[model samples]
Each structure stands twice: as C-alpha cells, then as structure tokens.
Target: MSGQAQSPAKPPPELSTSDASGTVSAVAGTLNGLPEDPQMTPLAPPRSTPPSKIPLRPRKIQKLSSDNLKPSMTNLSASAPKPPSSKKNRADARRSSSDALAVVIPRVAARSLSCEGEVETALRHLCAVDPLLVPLIEVHPPPNFDTFHSPFLALTKSILYQQLAYKAGTSIYSRFVALCGGEHGVVPEAVLSLNPQQLRQIGISGRKASYLHDLARKYQNGILSDSSIVNMDDKSLFTMLTMVNGIGSWSVHMFMIFSLHRPDVLPINDLGVRKGVQMLYGLEELPKPSQMDHLCEKWRPYRSVASWYLWRLSEAKGGPSGVASAMAATGVSVQHHQHQLQQPLPPPTEEQQQQLVDPINSILNLGYSEFHFSS
Candidate 1:
C-alpha cells in the first residue's frame, strides 16, 4: 500500500487428471469456471451431440418414369370434352371450307351455245324475257357453231380481216391460206416459218405482219394452244387472247360469241348493238357502252343470242331512220322514229360496215398512220 501500487495475485494453473479405467480426463480449473490459457487451443463445444436417433437423410430426388407421367384415365376423360355444335355452326364451317377451296381452284369453263339444245333453250329464254326479240329470232335462222375453225386459223383470219372491207379481208385471207399451203396447214409452225417479207408480199402491212408474228410466236412458245383455248373460261380466254398484239377487247367479244359460242357475252362496245338497243327502246341518242350492261341486264345468260338479233335488227332493211316502220311489222313499237320512218335509211357503206363490225381496225389504222409519219 505504498505509493508504488502493487499488482493483484494471479489465478492458479489448471490441474489435469487421467483415469486408468479409460474414462475421459477433466481439467479442474475449467470445471471450476476458470478462463482457459491464452496459448492453449479450445475444443469446439462437443459437436452438437448428434441426435441418438439419426435424423432421416433427406430423400434423393428422382426423375419420374414415362409410365408414371402418363395422364390418368379419369383426366383423359375430363379434358377437352367437345361442346355440342349447332346445325348453323356446322353449316358455317362447311361453307368456310368450301370458300377456301374455291380460292385455290380455277373456274371451270361454262357450257357454250354449241352444246346440244342450248340454242333452243336460249331462244325460249329470250322470247320469255323480251317479246321484242321474238320477231328477229323468227326472221333469222339460229346461229350454228358447228363450223368452228381451229383457234390458230380463226385467230389468223381475224387479224387479216380487222378493219378491212369484206372483199378485201377475204382476198387477204385467201392469199394467206395459199401461202401456208392451205387452211389445214395454218398451224403455228407454218405461220412462224413465213417471214415478214413473205407476209408483206401477200399484201399484209408491216404492222399486220408483226401482229401475226407475235400471235404465232405465242403459240409456238406454248403460251397458247388449241386445247387450252377450248378449255379456258370465257374471261380467261378473253384476257389471254387480248395479250396478242392486235386483238382488242372488241375482237375478243366477237370471238367469244362467234368462234367459241359463249352463251353469255354482250358486245357492249359494238356500234350495231348500241344502235339496235336505241331502236328497240326508241331512244333518241345511242346508248353509251357504260350503260349497255344495265340496259341489257335482262338479257343475261342468253345475251349472246340477244346480241345476234341486235346485229340483224340494226342492219335490217329499214335501218335507223325506218326502225319504226320495220319494227312495226314485228309488233315492236318504235314511236320515237315514227316521223323519220318516211325517210329511208341509206344502205350502210363499206366504211360504215367496218366501223360497226370492226371498229378496232379503224383505231389500228390511225395508229399505223401515226407510226408511219413518225418513222
């Protein structure tokens, strides 16, 4: 207790003991709650006395076998049970399926006028729908398509006849046939064999020779064939034919009605048809081509027959000025032209005939003239 401040006494060292009976030794100091020596290592609290009843080892994860993974019979019966469909739903599904099929399938060609009894059927239908046509139908013999020519020959003749007078067209066609050896030899190969010079020598203009060559080339290339032409639908045939150099929509209409004998074709652009419609209905001005479809809507399915009658009607003895007089005999009233009846309509000149029958020729001629001038 002097001013030197003496240190406190240290604790006694731990005493260790061993037993000969093989029991664990104990450290007396540690049992008495003395701190362990700093230099000595400590024992981990006797590894949490593992439960005497060992904890069940977690079960191992295993993949399920396919047999065990299969759906139960009860589940199969419960899942995807089809709801009952009404008749309307079934019909709608069928209709939609048919519509889808129609999109992929090409249209079948319709029966032509040449089919047996078709003319008679058309005549009866026309008479029933249009009383004004009865007289014309009776006056003119029914059209016969039995003499239909091969598509190549017919097309060749059409090209030759375009815009020419009857005599001139006939002369050119005769010469052309002779050049090809005969009508029987007017195949695509024979036509293609003829040079432009030879065609020109036969009185064919350079433009016409070019048109013929184009048609022949298309045929030779298999772009067109007689069988395909015969089997094609009217619209398909028309579209394909007009792809030829000189064949126009007007020519296609004429070919469809006369050559192919299509049952339902109306020459909406034909001057004769327009004039006939005007006279038949007694209109002051000619009917526009745009209005033809509506005005002649009643002539569907038998429009080709009606058109034939119109051609005859327009060229009948009295003509435009005397439609009233001529139609009066047929019991068709044309009161609009009653006053003009006394004035005879002069016979159509060659130019007028070409205009009415082959208007495309005139347009081609105009084009040819411009081409000539430009050249």
Candidate 2:
C-alpha cells in the first residue's frame, strides 16, 4: 500500500448527512454574529398593542382675528394632498359662476320716454279735461314722439331754414351738410373750419355764414353748450338763443315745440297758429298776439299739442278746424259755426303775406301793420 505511490494521496472522505447539518448550523451562527445590514433586513409584521383611553379635556379653538392672517405653507403641503386639476375644469367652474350671476341680475331697464303707459295716461287726462280734445283724441291715433334730436343739430338745421321756403331751405341744408362731412358730423369744429366764402359756396348766404360762425364760436367758448341748452328753462332758453345773430324768439319757439317736443310751447307769433286760433274761435279777425295767451288758456300744459292741431286747422277748408270734422266723422255731433260765409274776405295785407315767409316778423297786434320780435 505504501508502494501504491502512483495512487494519488487519499482525499478526505465526504461528510455524512448529520455532520453536514451540523456544519450548516455552525455557518448560520457565524452569520448571526455579524452586524445586520439595514437595507438588506426583512421588515417584521407590526405587533398588535392593547388600546388606551385618552382623557377628555374641553378647550376653545383660537380664532384668527386679522383678515390678513394666512395658514402656514408648511401645513398646506403636509395636509391631505389633492389630485391635480386641469385648466379646462377651472375655466368651466368660473364660467358657470358667471352664468349664475347673469341669471340673478336684470337685463332690460326702463329708459326715458320709453314708457307707453305715460302716453295713455296723458291721453286720458286730455279727454277728461277738454271735451273738444276728446273727439280729436278718439279720431287720431296717439302721437308717437319717439325721436329725440340733439338740440345743437336741430338749431343748426333751423339756422339753415330761416326766412327761406321749405324747398329752398332743404336744398341749402343738404349742400351745407355736404360741406361739413354729413348731418352727424355737423359739430362746432367742422362749422368753424369753413370760412364765410366756403359756406357761401355751399348755398349758405354770407349773413347766414356769419350766423353759423357766431354759433360755433359760442360753443367753442363754452358760453353755450348742448347740455346747457337742454337744461335751460323755456324763458331762459328763449333769452339765450335770441342772443345769437340769426336765432330769434319765433325760431326758438318752433325748435322747442318740434325739435325738443316740449309739452307746453305756444308759438304766439306763428301765423299758422294765429290763423288756427281765428278759425277755432270763429273770430271776425285774427286774434292779436297779446290776446293769444288769454284765448288759448284751456290748452295749457299741452299747448304744443294744441298748436300742432291748430296748424292743421288753417289748412282745413271748413268747420272748427279739422279736429272737429274728425269728431263728426266718428258720429259725434259738431256744433257748426253759425256765422254764414257771406262775401269773400279781403286779401291779407302785404305785411300779412310777408308773415307767411318771415318767422320772426309774424307777430302782429290787431290793426297794427308791423310787429317787432322781442326776446
């Protein structure tokens, strides 16, 4: 056996199962003796502890007194986290809130002169006050005064129409408006920009151009303004506008009645108004301008409306104006004028004929040939 030289040295024999188990236990004990790695350590299940009772104590929550006080930013981040929101959702929320506010608010509001109920009330008042006006009211549809023209613009147009026939005045006004940019563009600056020669070129006379310039300068100087004109009382307005070169009391009255739709203007100087008065009362001669205020006392507070009917009366052929004829047409009995139409009335004087064209010089006293306009 010693000579088995060539045979490799005998190797250690393999361990038995019992011996291997003991060796594995020794290795495991060596591993337990070493320090445990924190990351590599397996977590143990949480241990169940016995419940403890907390003693109740009452305390008031401290309230923040200052409006400027804010919660801590650190607490905000640490508290329950919210899921991210999209921009569209935030916009939708804002839009819904705005829509709710819109529904809660009102849309239409009452506006000046927009109340038709006022018109009905005025009509009822008129019918109750004057029996003659009742027929007129029933025969005609109610007057619809929806338009409110700027006083400045109306004054400008009235300036162009002064002392001229309707057609001639209209043509001149169109040309004048063209010179300035348009009707809407007829402001003080535009009128002032054009010289007397330029205005004359547009069919405005030299005198009328001077008048327009004077009006423009007054506006530029702040002595007269749209607001001032509109706010002025009737007497004060008559005085102020008459100070302008071409504007007169007659023109002011006409403007107040037609342009401003003033409720109680009586154009005593107006020829048509006088003629209407003559026919309404069946007078032998036209009533003097001085007597007009006394004769038409019943038409107060609605004199402008009465004046409108009066103008229609002069154009009518027979009866107590057209309004009475309208009453007769509606089955109401009209007390006809008992005065017979004998000889044809003499032609009106040259002064009276001039009144047909001249607005300012139309006021006349009975038997007086000429009358001057006073502010």
Candidate 3:
C-alpha cells in the first residue's frame, strides 16, 4: 500500500459488490427475559421537538451485552464495589435487570462497496496476505458495508465519543438515540421534536445540539444523502461533512467506518489506531501518519477491516476500552483510538494484576487497582 499524503483530494476507489448475508448468529440475554438486538432501531422521536434541547427521560437500566467487555480478558476481574447491601443495591440490581441499553447483536445490513477500478487492485492484494483478515472480506463483503442514514448523526455520535470512554459515550448516545426515536435509530421528526434547550436537556452539550439540529435539518432537506455522497469521492465527503459543527477528520474517519463504510480509512491521528500500531509493529511512538500509511499499505481494500481487527486486538491486549467510552468530556471513545498514556507495561497477566488502562474502571465509575474475583 502506498502511503500517500493525507489529502482531502485523494479519493478511495469503490469496491465491487459481493454477497455475504451469512451472519454468525447468537442469542443475547435481555431486559425482561426477552431477547433483543441492540442494533434494532428505536421508534421515531417526536417531530417538531423544541430547538431548545429537552431533558432526557428518567432512564431505565437494562442488561448489557456480554460482548461489551470481551471474555478473552477473563484472567482480569474487579468488581464494582458491591453497593450498600441495602435496598438501594437490591433495587439497583432489579432496575438494572432491565436497563434501556441491553446487549443485542449488531444487525449489520448488506451494503455494496463501490469504488473506482484501480483501488480494487491494491485492495485485493492486501486481503491475500493475511488469513485472519480474510474474514473481513467474507463477513464485511461489499454489501455489508453500505450505511443508509444521516452522516451527521453518525459523525455527531463520533464527536460525542471523542476521548470519552465507551460507557460515557453510550450514556450520551442512549439519550441522543432516545431523542431520535426510543433507543436505537434516528428519526428526523423525532429530532425535530424540541427546541435546542430540550436537546441540551437530553445531555447533549450545547455545541453538539447545534450540530445535531443542523444535521437533522440538512438530512430533512436532503443535503446529506447517499446519492449526494456517491458521486463525490472520500475527500469530497470529508469536506462536505466537516461543514457541520463539532465534526473533524477523526469524526469523519469514524463516519467512514460506520456510515460510509469506506474501505481503507486510515485514522493515523486516532489514539487507539496509534496504540494498536505500536503493539503490532513494535514502534516506540505511534508511527507517524507517513509511517502508518506504509504499514497499513497491505491492508488496502480491507484496511478498514484490518483497522477494526487491530482495534479489537488492542482491546484484548488489556486496555479493554474497545467500542465504549469512560470519560465524558472528550466524547471520543477512549479505546476507539489508541494513545500510550504511560509507557506500555511489561506484559502482565490476571493474577499478576496489571492496571493496563482499563476503561471499565472509569466507565463503571469504579476505583480499580488490579483484577480480583471472589466466588
């Protein structure tokens, strides 16, 4: 893969369509003993909402996804200090038995990867090199990558997640999702429900509310759309998207992954990507974007796929912040991007107890030291 400069002019060529509807299915525990898919869209948010953000409704606790925290790190364990063993903890447990954000298998839709012909040549070679990455070709095949939604909503969520822990972003997203619909999908009218104040009440920061409203209004009017995006290349998409409030290249990078599903998005600036690169390539500092472009060169068409795995690998190695947020301010998924805060620890195991930057500690609001489990 050639490490071209990160130019807004460089466009990612399209990928040919491949059908792969075969999903690895599994059951998830639920809010009321009923199975639920977390990716399921929520009912539409009320239309004509006040521009002033509305306050979020009282939240209900639901069971979380087992996948929220991967099982590979079983050696590590730290319990949320058993809350006061009083009625509070008991009620807490009961109420939490049905929190709104329960675990659900992400319902991935079939999407076609369309790009210029030349890019495909580079992408195919990259896929051949890694057997593990072969799954991305099969699982996320072209069709599985198409996203049909407002680019702005996805970008806003990404912004909200910047530097934040997964749980933190999830909390904010749940509220935002509630605004759009009930819990999972965004509805234009639902977002139009309240004035900005009502949006702020839902826990969206003042700036983010403006971004969402702009996104909604544009989406409502069709300024944001697949047809509009399809003709434009990646650079164009980035340029068009960043026009909204609170959006940046990093946020746009995330949008490429989840929304545009653009193949080959290299978020060299992303902390998680940097950390993962360090772990994989044995670098002292995150390889600079120039260096990263060279390293990721082989992952070409499947670079996005490879990047996704690299992120999972980082999570497994112990930071465990993948896909959730811990801190609230940055809203960036602390685990989503990788940055080495301190020198990487000499590898440690469960009994040894490494406080290897676990976001769960902060996200769950726990004071964690090492892993401990008591039967």
Per-candidate RMSD vs. true structure?
14.5, 20.0, 48.7
lDDT over C-alpha atoms for residue 360 of model 3: 22
At residue 169, give the lDDT of candidate 3: 57
lDDT of 1 by residue, 83-201 (tens): 43888877888898899999998632336776788888888888988888887787766654444466677677778877665457667878999998998898888988988899998
Total clashes in model 3, counting residue pairs 3 or more apart in sequence or in different chains: 59
lDDT of 2: 0.62
lDDT of 3 by residue, 243-320 (tens): 867667766666665456566678766555666778776678767766888887756555665665565455546543
Query: Where does candidate 1 stray beyond 4 Å?
Result: 1-110, 317-345, 349-351, 358-375
- Who is ahead in TM-score, 1 or 3? 1
Q: Each candidate's TM vs. the true structure?
A: 0.59, 0.55, 0.46
Over the stretch 1-375, how does candidate 2's per-residue lDDT look in tens digits?
766668667888898665565556566656889543333433343478988766587577888776538777778888966543888877887898899999999732312222356455556655666666665556445544444445666678777866654446667878888877786788999999998888878788899888888988898998888777766778888999999998877778866755555567788887768887887677999889999999887665677667755654453433223222222322334343212222223343455444443322111100100122122
> After TM-score superposition, what is the CA distance of residue 187 in candidate 2 from its true location, in Å?
0.8
User: What's the lDDT of the predicted structure labeled candidate 1?
Assistant: 0.69
> Alpha-carbon error at 170 in model 2, in Å?
1.5
RMSD of 2: 20.0
- Give the Å shift of residue 101 in candidate 2: 50
Query: Judged by TM-score, which candidate is best?
Result: 1
